[model samples]
Target: MLKARVITAIFLLIGFLAALFLLSPLGWTLLATVVAMLAAWEWGGLMRLVGIQRIAVALLLGVPCTTLMLAQPEALGLSGSLDKGAALSLAWWFLLPALGFWTLLVPLWLVRRFPLSGTAFGLLTGAVVLLPTWLALVLLRHLGPWALLGIMALVWIADIAAYFTGRAFGRRKLAPQISPGKTWEGAYGAVAGVLIYGLAVYFLSGSALALPLLLLIPTLLVLTAVSIIGDLFESLLKRQAGIKDSSQLLPGHGGILDRIDSLTSTLPLVTLLWLVL
Candidate 1:
């Protein structure tokens, strides 16, 4: 399993780096669209949409992304929208609200453990989570490959830290029903890891973004929590759907949705911050 995971990660990294460095603006849009298509398919599974229904849901979500990529409309408001696509313009509408949804609303929903199992609501949920993330990737890449990579690193650092910390010191369950493996200690470790990562970023390139070092900390802390919310969210969906790993699509990563679940929340919120700050 570990070997498979390592190999997959190597390939994923190679592909990501290739896309990051080699793709033109439109190429990146297409790349993001492909990701959206696969993610939408997995999201359909989470919604319990099978057969034609699965493809339908995936297409339903992916088509909008495709339109946004092709149209590149100026009305939606995006920095890099001029030549690439209107992904952010359309994305912001969803992702802006998503920022609030993941930050404040999701935590509450998790605590309550609402039985959100209806198909209509499930499709809506997929829209809320997947669309913005797809756009966020596009927007981040537009900002600069390093920008995307740096922000993404925060999540990676947090995830690794949380894993080790949780295994070493985890006691209390973070979400017993949704995910028994997660713990409060793990959550703290993730935050601590993000803080340190943020500091490193600040020292290295924070000035380039024009965000102050101190100011960046609070936002990173908030996003740190948001990243955790993203993970538990998919876990919740999987529990409700009665599935183990989203799908066996990847050798070790499980599925596209499973791999990018945290990204589904974190990236959009970060992109939102990028627009405002």
Candidate 2:
């Protein structure tokens, strides 16, 4: 299992890097939309929406995603304006759903462990989580591919730290029912790992979170925890769906949502903060 996972991860990283660096903005946008649509399909499965229901869900998401991208075809370019054009207007729109879902509802759902399976609420939750993350991907890629890459690296770092550290020294449960594999020690390790990465970006890259150095660390820490929220939220969905993985779409990676779960939370929030400041 471990070997399969490692090999899949390596190939995924390679393919991802190639697309990130080589694709034109329009090309990247199309690729991102396809990925989001696949996640939407898996999300529909979790909602127990079958056949036509799943196809409906896919079009429901894809149509709006197409609209958003069409709204700012140029803003996704290196020369596009993020301040005055469609991107800015939609950024404000994106901010509300992402913030509301992550800040108000998700934490409550996590604490309460609400019975959200196959419900309208679960469908709404999937929309809220998936849409803004898609928005973030487009906006960040437009800003610059490097910007997108750096922000994603933060989530990647946190996940890696949590995995290895949890394996080595995990003790107390982070959320026993939703995700038994998680641990408080792993959370701490993720924080430390993101901290190191954040500071490295701050000092070395000089592309820290457009905030004071002291303030950036706290922001990174919050984002780290938020990434965990994203991970656990999907785990909860899979739990309610009574499944071990979202789907066996990626040899060892489970599915699209399984791979990008953390990004679903972290990316939108990070982009919101970036746009705000």
Off by over 4 Å in 1: 73-92, 206-209
Range of the 10 consecutive residues with the lowest summed lDDT in candidate 2: 75-84
TM-score per model over all chains: 0.92, 0.92
- Which RMSD does model 2 reach against the true structure? 2.0
Residues 212-235, candidate 1: write the lDDT tens digits: 876787888888888899999989
Best by TM-score: 2
Deviation (Å) of 263 in candidate 2: 0.5
Scored by CA lDDT, what does every candidate get? 0.81, 0.83
TM-score of 1: 0.92
